[model samples]
Target: MSRAIRRNSLTEQATDALLDYIAERQLGEGDSLPPTGELAATFEVSVPVIREAIAALSGIGLLRRQQGRESVVAAPGATHLSRLLTLRVAHAAVEDDAIQQYREVVEVGSARLAASNRSEESLRELDDALADLRAVADDESLHAADIAFHAALARASGNDLFVLTIDALQPLLHRLRRRVWSGWVNSGGDLTSIVEAHATILERVRERDADGAARAMTDHLAQARLGLDVLSGHVGDSPARD
Candidate 1:
């Protein structure tokens, strides 16, 4: 057994061992895995434990299994994460939860930094984006521009981690934005109201009011969630997604 393997949970040990093996061997997609018996022996665990570990990895699309054959490494993609986000939004609409809490933290922290660090040029860029969002008739275009605006704010934070985190979150955020806007439109909420909410956030940032910008962003997200809930006819109340 590797010295790094945990002595506690067999599942944890199995998971760590498989990940370490993949990393050390530089395994790639479609690569045949070693036999489960070999993995069981290597980890000093039962075949069933190893099987459970493989099943977990397969669930994440990180491994593929064949009858009477070694499992194969799989190409990991964003599909799993996208599904997670869909489930999260479906749950968040009805009950305030940790995901919403964490999202607020990211949004407020990024907005505050943006307010303090944004340059005149960046502000102008945001203005143009807002204008484009207002003019776009297609919901997809509007949602894309909205994401661009928020990502620009993250970049303005002058923090590389913040920028990367926001970038990684772009896909899910774009999906959520579309859902929210579609709901708002169906609920008879004016598009101008949504655009003006974003404008207020930008205005606060431009004025260098960090606290005000953070609050505005929180409000904007809360309203967005409500709008989505109404539009989906409470479909967002469920905590699971297909």
Candidate 2:
């Protein structure tokens, strides 16, 4: 039996109740939700209230609605997460350093996983992205290739969540990278070492050397940290590239 929602905040309470119901029932992506009429009865609310609640859930990527079909559970992808993250950043709820640190943890783990689970197709994709990165000179071209390379690396991890998360964060990460690139250019640094770092990581993944891949990624991120600091307006001598 569903618990009755309080009347004080019908839509908000119904939304919370629906979320609890989904979790209690262990609903997975694509599981069809009960019809709005049925949900209204279950929550002891009016049908219109239930509709509004469903709309609220759909707004946050928790539900998918069809014109005449029942709504289904949704798998929050890059678009949804990016929207939420952008909102949080705009409100100053999250800072660039927090984003950078989170990426380092996820990406290092992704490198290790990719070394063990990467497929030939993913390897080829990474190689192509790296090739493009090596060849691109303009910031726009480099940004596109850089994003592709990171996305490919995360995809190679064979974890959908990692792929979703890194993809969502790429826009934020690009801002940091752009700052780093601008500083590097002004300081007369070349792209050779950056390309070399990625090559080493891909080679380690190809050899199935999980530990080596992890270490290489750690080193690469350490270099990126220098640029991220610069982005945060911490002026200092640029870190030397190998």
Candidate 3:
């Protein structure tokens, strides 16, 4: 019996104990957890309390529960982070520039890695995303294609962590991309140049030129910064357009 010593709230204590149980047993994705009754008995809590703890864990993607089946450890995902960011943006809890800066760090590094690690399949995905981006006339579809391009680049980096972070950022990036692109259009900016920027990055990555890929990504981000500045009234027309 894995006894849960009460430290704070009973539910919290039970949750902690449950986590300990999982770690102790080295449970992994698809690994079934012991029954609720067994957990309740071990934690010295009522079955309802144990269920509450399980629910809390499940909410965060730590466990998957189903009717008539034992709860299993879940495969990790960005779903919780994605939802949290979407909600934060909804409530204005985070700034767009902050999000953009964080993206600069993650994506620049991803572009660099992708140049060295990309496969034929990832290159094909990037080509498809770029084609969609070039073809889209509407804001919604353009933003979707832009995100697909970035997400595919992140995947090409051959890093699971990068893929997860970019996946978590997709919803937020879609809104930001729409805002930036719309602002640029409203300011008489050429959307063709925007597509060309992505094309340059892909060209460098496809050539396996790591430093060139990083520089292309950096330039792309600089252009986005100009768009953001124009949107925020920090600049009147992007100087890059001059």
Q: Which candidate is the best by lDDT?
A: 3
lDDT of 1 by residue, 140-233 (tens): 8888888888878887777776776667666666656766777767767777877888899899999999999998888777766665677657
TM-score of each model, in listed order: 0.57, 0.86, 0.88
Query: For model 1, which pairs clash?
Result: none
lDDT of 3 by residue, 152-230 (tens): 9999999999998789878888777877876677667777988999999999999999999999999888777777777
Query: What's the lDDT for residue 23 in model 2?
Result: 98
**RMSD of candidates 1 onward, in order:** 9.1, 4.8, 5.0
What is the Å distance of residue 231 in model 1 from its true position?
4.2
**Ranking of candidates on lDDT, top first:** 3, 2, 1
Q: What residue runs in model 3 are displaced by over 4 Å at the alpha carbon?
A: 1-7, 89-92, 236-242
- CA-lDDT, candidates in order: 0.78, 0.86, 0.88
> If ranked by TM-score, best first, what sequence of candidates would result?
3, 2, 1
Judged by whole-model lDDT over C-alpha atoms, candidate 2 comes out at: 0.86
Give me the runs in candidate 1 sitting further than 4 Å from their true place: 1-101, 231-242
Model 2 agreement with the true structure over 15-80: per-residue lDDT tens digits = 999999999999999999999999999999999999999999999899999999999999777999
Model 3, C-alpha of 42: deviation from truth (Å): 2.8
